[model samples]
Target: MKRIPMEIKVLIAIFLAGVISVLWYVYDTKAKRRAEAAAPTPISQPIDP
Candidate 1:
């Protein structure tokens, strides 16, 4: 079997990292949006004791 070139291996590693980063961004954004949506709004507090 022939050994792979170092340059090509480095390129492939960089590409995979980019894909993983994009996927994570999407996942985190969705999670944050959902959490914000499900959270309750704060009510105004009375000043009088």
Candidate 2:
């Protein structure tokens, strides 16, 4: 059996991290949209110091 090189392993790890980040971002965005849609409307008010 041939062993894998360290550089290739590092590259694979980085690639996996990028893929995971993209998936998480998509899931988070969808969840945020759903939450926003389900939220109640807020009363109109102006911010005051």
Candidate 3:
């Protein structure tokens, strides 16, 4: 088996990290939107004398 160089390994790691972060961001944004949508809106009350 051939040995991989350190530079190539570092590049691969960086690329994988970038991809994972992007996926996480997309997932988080969608979850927040879903939560917001499922939440109830507050109604304004009129002041009575």
Q: What is the TM-score of each candidate against the true structure?
A: 0.78, 0.79, 0.78
Error of 2 at 9 (Å): 0.2
In the range 1-49, model 2's lDDT, one tens digit per residue, is 8999999999999999999999999999888778767867422344468
- Per-candidate local distance difference test: 0.83, 0.84, 0.84
Where model 1 places Cα greater than 4 Å from the true spot, the runs are: 42-49
Which portions of model 2 miss their true places by more than 4 Å? 42-49
lDDT at 40, model 1: 73
Model 3 clashes, total count: 0
Residue-wise lDDT of candidate 1 within 1-49, one digit each (tens)?
9999999999999999999999999999888778767867422334467
TM-score of 2: 0.79
**Candidates 1 and 3 compared by lDDT, better number:** 3
Pairs in clash, predicted candidate 3 = none
